[model samples]
Target: MKKNFKLLMLAVFVAAASCSFTTKSFEDPDKDKLLIDLITYVLEKGHYDAKQFDDSFSEAVYKDFINNVDPIKRYFLASDIAEFEQYKTSIDDQLLAKELDFFNLVYSRLDQRIKEAQTYYPEILDKPFDFSVSEEINVDYENLPYASNKKELKDRWRKQLKYTTLSTYYDNIEDNLFKIENEEDYTPKTKAQLEADARETTLNSFNDNYSFVNDLERNDYFAVFLNSVVTQFDPHTNYFAPPDRDRFDLQMSGRLEGIGARLQKQSDYIKVVEVISGGPAWRGEHIEVGDVILKVRQEDETDPTSIVGMRVDDAVKLIKGPKGTQVTLTIKRVDGTIEEETITRDVVEIGETYAKSAIIEKEDRKFGLINLPAFYFTMQDYEERNAAADVKKEILELKQQGMEGLVLDLRNNGGGSLRTAVDIAGLFIKEGPVVQVASNGKRKEVLSDRDSEIVWDGPLVILVNDASASASEILAAAMQDYKRAVIIGSKQTYGKGTVQNLLDLNQWLRNNDMGDMGALKLTTQKYYRVNGGSTQLEGVKSDVVMPGRYAYLDIGEKEYDNPLPYDKITPANYSPYDGYIDYESTIKRSNERMAKSAELKLIEENAKWIKQRQDENVVSLNLEAYTQAIKDREQYAKRFDVLEDYQSGLNFKSLPKELGLIEIDSTLGQNRQRWHKNLRSDIYVEEAVSVLEDLKLNNIRQGSLAKIKD
Candidate 1:
């Protein structure tokens, strides 16, 4: 499945790039004249003129930008209308005199704004944005014909601008600054004190904005501006000029050049989030998540530099380097003891952040589980061929190997291609409607299964948590609506049921010669379940809710800024699953079992552990306190194992033995075990097996059992 997916994604990337460059003529105005006029103006005024800008540069930036921003050739805003009025005869004068100045002025203002915003960023690190006092601010668009004339609109603008200023200020401050302790000058403000001050400032600013803003539309506009500006460059080339991108890459890829541990920003400190599965940090068994990084130094350096309160990303850059390089990290563990560890860099793979599967066996029944780490597909691989088809093939192979039921694990799956999701869901049910999309009230599209075959017909389950979002929610919601599977896991999914369209900014501004201003991924549509419910902030509720580690954390769709409101639509007609086995009793029994299990109890106890980790933000001047903190967390974590012994009463010694076969290579054998372990933790798979068992038992009890004679 992985191999096929990689190939497919590669194809998609190539196709996307090709499609973007294939030019088409515009319907309005003279295309050649417009292009020449814009190009001439750009050449005269742009910092890099026609001599510096080649054909590739012109096509990439100017043409692409026009294609994205002015596709329709009709102005949507009064500002746009006014701007075009000046350039009616020729845009050359405006471009040379005013437009260049505007771009330069805007860029300069943004730079200054970023700097001003950074001054208050430490506050956000000290105290995160508080949304507890947020109230639903609705807009009365019906009464307000002209937004400029409405008094309420003005008031909304005032409040929104203030919040926007504050938010931008905070983002800039956080993005640019790094916290480091001056060990030699520890006379007045301690690291903790500085962080506290920053927190207070952020909270105060947040409160000021929250108290004033009273309209959702105003808030949305503010957010849109911020996002649009950041997205104006290449997708990976962000406005954050700090060294944090390298750190972010380390975290997302689950690999670092130097120390093999995951780090996160906690208040002001760079805390260890997790030790990579088989990395240097994990091998040392000293550095763990919840351990605070206090100082770092090169192996040969004499003085260990303090890094407390530093931006997590910047700190990560100072730590990570080329392979075989050595660096020393001074860590304050959860128990408050501080220690320094010297580690060498090596290639590390974040194995945890990928798709895996497992098997759940109870009594004589066996269920297969597939846990998708993320809805990730390399762009090039997907466009050449469909990855979902490969997954279906794997599912069939699992079924052929004696799997009776299936569990699709989508915890922390933050969605990918909409097409892939539709295809994947189509694998289970017969050709039918999967999801309904509503846009502009006039356009409603029902994405359905055009395929005619059903891959697996036995009991099915889908496990989701607060992190299960977008495409993940789509599949889970579809199954639940069709009564084809039972949904299990958190109380609700991460309700991100909206779709986005990625627009190339360069293409949009094709005739203007603006250089690549990048692209804008805009929210275009909202997805709805077949039954008509929209999974916006209110995600899909699980039929059986399970305890999750992130229960206390604000996760999912509700946590996003200016999220779209949830609304329902008229129900669409679709055939229901035939003989859908009732699983209420099975759910009850599973809940009862989970409630009694000591292992499950340990998982529930992790909430307190997580909170304790969050609360101990203050770092110590003394090393003992830091070391103790790390030890305490390790002790607490050791109280419960992440993986349980599910094979105590089973017949096999090793995973390969249990499967009753050997793969061609050790890598394949290891992959199979990883797949099996992922499948075992699948709550949905467990529920499905129980459901099927109950169905069988109930039939016998009622003398309605139909035997399939061989």
Candidate 2:
């Protein structure tokens, strides 16, 4: 339940929720109203822990919907809020009746307010900001009250614009000073000219943002309102619009038929932020990051269409096509040279998404490290490109290389297939219950490792962090409970113990007249560890709690809004494995070493300082105060520069299997080398290795054979 969220959230693989609802909207007249009825029924019937569609649900939706539309309170005023309050509690009534009067009224007012608000930015940015005034800006918008009138709204916009301009002004000043110092004959611009340039930058940024906002269609806004309604039930539950659902699929698979470049809309220009490593763009070597794509021409067309001011998704639609298709791009390079590059579109597979392995040699002892990015599996084929099979293959290859110890790095692994996690867990252990899953009205189902074979019977260590969630937590919790692997890294993993699955809304309708009604991702179940403890708010506690950047941050499932509470269940009937020597004492020894370690101490201190900096939200508008703030931050940053310098002399190398891949693309080899260098510098990795060495050096086998119990 709690462990399989990511896997379940991957909706591309899941079939239509059920053969279930009302097929056609007869007298509703409006499609939006019909959609509300359809979604409401689905939510009420399908959701595992469905909240009642009453006044309370209505109020929740109202708050979420209003906030989402005008999050910064830049458009709607206090009067608008007062006006909307009439229908706040009545939304449930509206939802029940399939009425759109409240939505229509609010939408119209918001649309008018948006048009009016556009004038404010241009007018406010027309003049230079007086940074000499001893004023402070509080960017914590949630705590602040909305403006009561147009005058107050204008003043609010003015202060925000001033803050944005002030930051840009300071940046320009620094750049100017740097140029004056470095360039022998460089002429520095006057303060007034720099100030004007800063204002222009601010103007461009706001205009670009407003253009994006203005370009949003009614359907897009409808999606926002729909999401607000759905997500109010739970943070995980959401309604993915058609385009969003498609986008989600693209993201999940990480393979798309395109020219293979990520585009960003920057001030009316579509910029190439990243050229996928193995994509057509990287193969051509013609396109690079920071290159602005000006126009796009398809093979069938004679003229290239100017894509300036085009929405990113729209631009992407034009750029992406089936494999073997040729698309010509007119790109403005960072150096200002415009070039026409024609790239043949191909299936761009994101290599980093898959499981990768590296072998580290220290003091003549070889240690294999398998980094599982996600508990991934091919949607079309169960056996193809799955993390479980990939891990098994990697482990077999590593074993052939005379590997002494293994480190399964699960840090930042948000998780994928629940079955894959169980399968992967089975690789190390002989056979036992891996996890216990429970849903509404279902018996506690035990996901067990029935195979009584140990793939890797050597020293094992699992690395995790605050970002390691869902299936990651399952694997960590299982290992920790059985005392099979030494869990190391952050205080605990991300406590997302609940599961979600997609239910296609179209499936609900029988005599369907309405078009494809996307899908609803609802929390269908919750899972518990073998030890009965729920890895919900309280995540899998590491045997060796290492300090990290996220150590002091308000992060993980506990920090998330409206997360399911943590609890415990009946501990699965299984005996703890005592296969290794002094497992308890080994953890004790690791903790003892970590207590006095300077590297871990520095990490904790650095994390605390970062949290402090994050909490300090108020910004000084005065030039001297702003400059001093930067200087202070820079000085503080310098103190932690030594953190990177500390390195363990571990030699890391690519496995024999990836050698061919490295040969084909030297970038692959370079990446491996880079990762190896980082691993050598990684304090957490160093500590894990240290713990593994301790376990390896002083182990007394409790059992003669690594076999499963009956």
Candidate 3:
């Protein structure tokens, strides 16, 4: 119902613009009377009570309409500004009456313009839109800092309309919408029906100016705007609208009384993005990712109320409540089965929010795996207690634990603070630039570590997948450029290199009385690696590439609309690590072993099997096929050996009394021997260890280092 307010307001605004309503025209008295009568007719039909049409409300509405509709406000000519001086001051009664007449004249002109616009609106539907006509869509930053003038606002609408209309032709909206359903439930619609529906939906809501202005009224627009503003001040200071604020409050302090799942509005239907790790939904084992939520029923409710087309936060409110309360969700599963599941909510603690460390012992070498879910630090907490210092302490502990090699798993780590990323990268590098920021043609600021102390410098590797973005990409690129760590992951990262400036649209137009125009997230700058490569569309490439499920999908910066173009800048002079480890021969040997091994060969050969599981669109029409698909996928994934297998092999190698002597001596020998012996059993871990050993043996190992006792 709260969401409906925004939609209704937009509909009313659009309807008003489309109607043939005008004010009294001074040039033609008869036309002016006709216009006034028309306005009266609309007012009556719109259910605006004639009795409640007070002077104050009229003034407010009139001012709002003028600001919204007047082309002069968006782009006021010098002469027009001069002409408006007569209306600036309060006048005598006689003069006031004349001024109102002049105002009516201007209002009538705007009314005529709107009527003229309607004629073209229907024509836009009939005409086939050609998107190839590229126009220079650059905004004049100097002239219009904020779109306050009416003409400038119209131009913004023109550009927005052109882009949006062009986009509709390229995007298969029907396919995207229908893709939410499971393949089994998919009743294929004829191409004609799909096209007709798509076109109708698009055309019915095609007014650019109305949408542009209406978005300024919706809470999400302000939520994103305020987030941008707070982010500009610092990444942690966020602005949340009512729904977002409610969600945040629930996540931080509220108890979950319903199913524990984070939902998002994916087009029309609500899709489950994540199931709370230990919540009832996760424990129930019925809900899974990619499942569409159709309805939700409260404990006392008899009928399940449909939740389709509801905002994510609204759906969340319906699903979340006090602990002990039961909530039922009608879920459409990935396999096309719709089922109702009831869950009792409880307190949800975010245990998986931080960086978790694990020791994966492959052969003999123990590799420390640190999975950083997000580069997060509460700014308020940091201000009160030293958070960066604490993270450094943890890294030092991992290093002290006798970790031969390290894997910084940054999968699904949507970036948080820039400050934290730089600080974390500083733990690896001694003292150098980590990332560079170029904004508004100002002197580029190089963020670097001033500290000389280094931690975990032995053999470092960073693992990332498609979801690794922003600050994650920044750190990965810096480490890769400096040759500090070997990056192993998918083809590239989610390339979001541009920086945005949060402009308070309300603040800029305070004098104009534009209530809650919200904030604008204007892309103001871009980040560049110290080596001069831009991380825009082409994200950082891994040193050792690994196959990922989303490898075939168009996953990165190129998939977004109006993504900033990638460009290079002057490279800052920085020292590269001169010391190299001799891991070449060991890597070659490990690669040969992995290539010929039947288990590894089988896993590699079953790429298609993995792909089918990864693909979101691959659906089964029947229960049998779906069961078989799931079975086949599970069987193929199990070909990869577990960590215990490597440990068993290492134990087996030390079975003979003579093998114990070799093991003892190997540990006492150079780090390379210890690494080689440790890597022998765990294929992948051993491969990384061998690479480190080869680097050490090659005499290219940089910096003076000492091996610490575990």
Off by over 4 Å in 3: 1-242, 245-349, 381-391, 441-443, 501-522, 583-710
Better of 2 and 3 by lDDT: 2
For candidate 1, write residues 1-710 as lDDT tens digits. 00111111112112112111111212222332333343333323321101232333323333223222222221112343343333233323333332333222323433332233334333324443332233222222212232332244334333332233333443343433433233443345443444444445545544433222211122122222223222222221122111222333433343446667777665557888767656777766768789898999987788988877554445776788788888888888799998888888776656555454455566676667666765544343554434365457657767766776677778778776677778888887767888998764446899999986667666777888888888889888998888777787888988887776544434536365533333334555778999999998899998777767767666766664335678899777898775444556666776776677665566667865675554442333222343355577678787656535433332111333324433433444676666556445644445545655553223342232123211
Off by over 4 Å in 1: 1-365, 374-383, 511-514, 641-692, 695-710
Candidate 3 residue-pair clash tally: 31
Q: Report the Cα lDDT for candidate 2.
A: 0.80
Model 3 misses residue 628 by how many Å? 9.5
TM-score between candidate 1 and the true structure? 0.51
lDDT of 3 by residue, 1-710 (tens): 00111121123243333222111112443322332333233323321112233443333333333333342232333454355444333212212132334354444454444454455445545544333343533322223344545555455445433434433432344464556575777666654454455455555665533333322222222132123212222222233333443344333222334567777665567899887666777767869999999999998999998988664555777888888888888999999999998888875644456564545555666556666777665433544322245456556665665666666768777776677788888877778998888875456888888777677566777877777888889999998888777776666888878664333434433354322332333455678898988888788886655545456555676774335668888887788654444333433454565556554444344544555444333233232343455577667566654422544242111112224444544322343344345544544443454455444512334324432211
Best by lDDT: 2
Evaluated at residue 338, the lDDT of candidate 2 is: 92
Model 1 lDDT vs. the true structure? 0.54
Pick the TM-score winner. 2
All candidates' lDDT scores?
A: 0.54, 0.80, 0.54
Select the stronger candidate by TM-score from 1 and 3: 1
**Candidate 2 to truth, TM:** 0.89
Worst 10 residues of 2 by lDDT: 7-16
* Candidate 2 residue runs with Cα over 4 Å from true position: 1-29, 266-271, 284-310, 321-344, 510-514, 663-670, 697-710
Ranking of predictions according to TM-score: 2, 1, 3
